[model samples]
Target: MNLDDDIALAHALADAAGAVIRPYFRARFVQEAKADASPVTQADREAEEAIRALIEEHRAGDGIIGEEYGAARADAERVWVLDPIDGTRAFIGGRPIFGTLIALMIEGHPVLGVIDQPISSERWIGAAGRPTRFNGKPAGTRACPELSRALFATTAPWFCGGFEALRSAAGDTLLGGDCYNYALLASGHGDLVVEEGLKLHDWAALLPVVEGAGGRMTDWHGQSLHKGSDGRVVAVGDPALLPQVLELLER
Candidate 1:
């Protein structure tokens, strides 16, 4: 497969989503709760529609798995996973940290990912065998000297276990960025992100971004992530800290 072509299409998908989402950022619109009680809005539905339309136009053979819309042609060798508005809570509250998550999975493994924050105009792109780029500039993670001095982050402590331990071990803690936290980690703005109960749409796009930016993303057990992974996730910008961090998580 020509990865460059897929990467270009992914960017177009993000652009389509962003165009649909920008106008709804702080505007009054329909917001409804899903079966899981998570918020879904008009922007979320329309953005996913926008992205899906582009994918059908450009890559009709590829499969699709989306947050607002269900799966289609899911058994294909290549699939596009999308979460149009990953942090709807933040978006509804006028926070710009929410993002559109897009990932291309080959044989159920993520090989390309994009995290785009349209309101902020920040985009991070990562592909297998390629270094990550943010806003078209190479992006690399900062060296995390040690776990104790790390800047730990999570969307919400309740989403995972061992929060208290990690919070105390790290130098500081920041909360509530959802997919944006992983993007920040890719850009060296944070050291780690641990969360759980994420669906395929939630975490699939993150693997390439974190790993491509000189970091590691895996289940709490330190195994590589895939379609069947248990929801718990750990992302460390400096790979060496994974063991120490996992040790605390296992306690």
Candidate 2:
């Protein structure tokens, strides 16, 4: 398979999702509570449908794991993981930090990922063996060797363990950026991101985006993230901070 072809398809998928999402931003819409009590809106469902439709038309054989819709052909060798609106709360609150997350998993490993912020029209695409790009320009993380000098980001404190310790250790902290935090980290805007309770669709797309931009992402235990990860994830713009971050997380 031509990797470029797949990468192009990934961009198209993001475009499709963005098109569906832009109209709903800050517009009147009803939000419903899911079984897990998380918010879901029409934009989330419609955007995922748009993305799934494009994947079906172009890559019919591939599997799909979506946030709104359940899995289809999940055992296939190649699967697409999608989260139409990763930060529904932020989206509902008219915040632009929510993003559309898309990832192509080949044989259970993510090979490409896209994080698209529809309202801002900022896109970050990352593929294995290639530099990450933000709006067609190469994006990279900055060097911050120590946690005390890092700018930390997370959506909420409840999703993280040792939140107070880590927050206090970091040089600066900003809250509420959902998947966009990873995009910022990839673009040298942030230094660290740590969160828990993320689903595959929530984080699968982040691995490639973070890793391809001179950053590292792993579980709280410092293991590689995979389909079975426990949802505790930590991302650092500089890998040197991982050990220190992990130590504080264990406290």
Candidate 3:
């Protein structure tokens, strides 16, 4: 499939997964703890299963790496990375910040991405070499220039190695999870988002969205992100501001 077709397929998949997850938002459900002590609910598993099923049926030869179910069909050149419900804690607590994240990674680089927030009725899609869009209209990142004027965000304060330094740099901070912060960054509503303690599924889908919207998405070390990375994720609106922040972290 061509890039547009692939991006369309990803959007469809994200919409389908959102359909499965939206009903559970703000509704009480059985919540359980994973071995890692993170919370999981029927919504999380069911949404992931739904997305995986779509990928398996529609792109049978492609591999998948999902947050809830782990990896499947690992050797395919094109892989679908999924985070069915990126902000489970927010979902469980009746917050609308949660969303479904999906991406197509071809030969290890994210080329297409979708972040669907059903509650807000917002969907952001991005593909390599194409403009980023929100519900089909073009979108771009905010134009914050320096740390002193930037609005930084993260899932929590403790996730990044340079949390103290970043907090000190930004004019304001928005504490939240992956997809929500990514959406804000893409919409020109937030300037920077730093995430640490992430798996490939968490960051993979976000790379295309951030980059396509004229922003930078990379590990804290100023290196490109990969499936094997476990360091902090630093996303920023202006590419010019990223290296400065990265250098601060490296100090």
Using lDDT, give the best candidate's number.
Answer: 1
Order the candidates by TM-score, highest first.
1, 2, 3
- Residue-by-residue lDDT tens digits, candidate 2, 98-141: 99999999878888999999898899999999999999999999
Give the Cα-based TM-score of candidate 2 against the true structure. Answer: 0.98
- Each model's lDDT comes to 0.94, 0.93, 0.86
TM-score of each: 0.99, 0.98, 0.96
Question: Model 3: which ten-residue window has the lowest total lDDT?
Answer: 225-234
Cα lDDT tens digits for candidate 1, 1-251: 69999999999999999999999888989999999898999999999999999999989999999999999999999999999999999999999999999999999899999999999899999999999999999999889969898999998889868999999999899999999999999999999899999999999999999999999999999999999999899999999889989999898
- List the candidate numbers ranked by lDDT, top first: 1, 2, 3
Question: What lDDT does candidate 2 reach at residue 5?
Answer: 92
Clashing pairs in 3: none
Write the residue-wise lDDT of candidate 3 on 143-240 in tens digits. Answer: 88888999988888877678788888889888876578988899899998887888888788888888989998988888888767775788999987
Q: Clashing pairs in model 1? A: none
Cα deviation at 75, candidate 2, in Å, is 0.8
Please report the TM-score between candidate 1 and the true structure.
0.99
Clashes of each: 0, 0, 0
